[model samples]
Target: MGAPFEIGYVFSFLPKLLETLGVTLLIVAGSLLTGIVAGFLVALPRMYKIPVLRTLSGLYLSFFRGTPILIQLFLFYYGLPELLKPLGFDLSRAPVLFFVILAYGLHTGAYAAEMIRASVEAVDRGQVEAAYASGMTSYRAFSRIVLPQALAIAVPVFSNLVIALLKDTSLAFTLGVMEMTGKAQTLGTLTQHFFETYIALALIYLVISFTLEKVLLAAEQRLKRHEAREEKAGRSFKLRRKGSYRAVLADIDAGKGGRL
Candidate 1:
């Protein structure tokens, strides 16, 4: 018969798993920071339609997006050192966390580049033209007008990528990073309570993921509210202008009729 369920093991291992949750968060945070910066850089060429840069950016996306993340991690962790060896660089001495972060960052960056590109493209051209017509420089127009709108459009998609990155951080365990998944594995092996250990791990992940979703949803609603206010104000201004024009037309009619 299979080992009987030990309800006590779940509570016993919960703290250990929670302790490693911070490590998981660290991996996610590092990867996100690097990935976001890289993604923006990768997106620039595509957004501006630069000839050679766009071609290179497309290749970057194709390679990173097409490959599985695990393979990417291996490539970054193992392959980078080999290539850099001739340059007197030894990645083997560096902390595994560096490689883990690099791998996840590169992997996440590809998806982020596409998301950023799409978001930037989604911004209304009319708004951009209006900014330019108002004497805004290209950079100023993008920063003041296009970027804000693009960020709002990108947030929903970015939130999804954040969640995915959180889950993907589990792969860091392969590099001996004792993240939540790694800690859970250790607990499972030591106590021989696989199901209980994994259940605790799963719960921790679910709770964090749920919290992120709620926070992101709240931010999304706030952006929507701000947009709604701007739209309402625009409509109100238009209505007031229309009312003033009607009053002017009525005055003209009254003056003409009196003369008649």
Candidate 2:
């Protein structure tokens, strides 16, 4: 007969699993940092329609997005070493965690590039025009005006990506990394309690995902509040401009009448 479910095993394994949580988080954090920077670089070319760069960026998106992440991991782990052997540089000697970061970062960056492009494009053209009319340089205008709005739009999407990447880090176990999943697997095998171990693992992931969702939601609300203030300020400026225009018109009429 199969062993009955033991709730105790779940609790017992929790600490062991948590011990490796740092590795999992490191992989996620490293990958995300790389992804954000790479994604932005990829996005700029596509955003500005820089012919050759745009094409290359599109191809990058296609190749990364088209393939499964597992395949990408394999390619980075195995194929990369083989490719580099001809150059007298050995990739195998490097840490597996580094390749995990590379694979996931490339994967995340492709999707992030598109998200960034969409968010930037979503900013109102009038906002850009106003920035230019205010004598702001292109870089200054974009950084001050366009980027703020685009980031607010992109934050929710990026939050989702964070959760996805967190889950994807489980695949690192396949590369022999003793991350959360790897630790869980060892505990489960030793204890002959696969179900309980997995339940604990799932709970850990759920807690992290839920916490991130809440944090991101709060950030979104704050951005909305800031945007509301900007809108109110804009209306006040328009009203003051209208009042000034009316006063100028009254003064011009008074001068004309006196002359007549």
Candidate 3:
């Protein structure tokens, strides 16, 4: 006889699975945080090139993106310790959690770099040039004029990256880091109720992922709407502020004021 799939199974086991949920969420949070910081650093070189650093950063992105993440994970978890020992680094006390984060960070950072660079580039060149012409230093111009616009452009890309990172957290289980999938596998093995365990796990993942996607989409839409409204307000203000200039020009051309 097969095990029944019922609400009882979920309610009963869900509390017991808190440890697994904690680990899974930790991996996702750790990876995304580390990856974004790495990516932000990588983005600088391309956005404002220091020739050698830019080349090196580009190489970093290319190599990571070109390789499979699973291989990268295996190499970091299995192979790097061997390499690091000779370099006089001790990895003995390091948990598998760190490797999961390292693998995810390097893999995701490569993609984030490209997305960020594109965002920075998407900023209007004229705005940057105007800042420079106004005596703003390169750094000042970038901070004030470039980065804000770039962030707006990058938000959508980053939201998707967050979703990808959420899914990729499952890979940690392969490395003996007992996250959600790992826990579910353990349950299935114990009870032989493969279908029940797996379906529940799938639903959990679906719920979390769907929730994050909706949040990101909502935030992205709000940002875009805010940007659009700001632009409209800026235009309206510029027109109103320059009313005298237009009125004078109209007076010169028409010999008198008609209706503004």
lDDT for model 3, please: 0.78
For candidate 3, the TM-score is: 0.80
lDDT of 1 by residue, 42-118 (tens): 99899889999999999999999999898888888889999999999877799999999988998899999988987
Candidate closer to the true structure by lDDT (higher is better), 1 or 2: 2
lDDT for position 201 in model 1: 84
Model 2 lDDT vs. the true structure?
0.85
**Per-candidate TM vs. native?**
0.86, 0.86, 0.80
The digit string of per-residue lDDT tens for model 3 on 1-260 reads: 55666656765556556558888888888888788888988988887788999999989998898898888999899877888999999896689999889899878888888888877766667788899999999989988888777776677788788888878887778899889888987887787676777777877788888998788788777656756686677652211213346434532424434435
Q: Model 1 reaches what TM-score against the true structure? A: 0.86
Q: List the residue pairs that clash in candidate 3.
A: none
For candidate 3, give the lDDT of residue 135.
100
Best by lDDT: 2
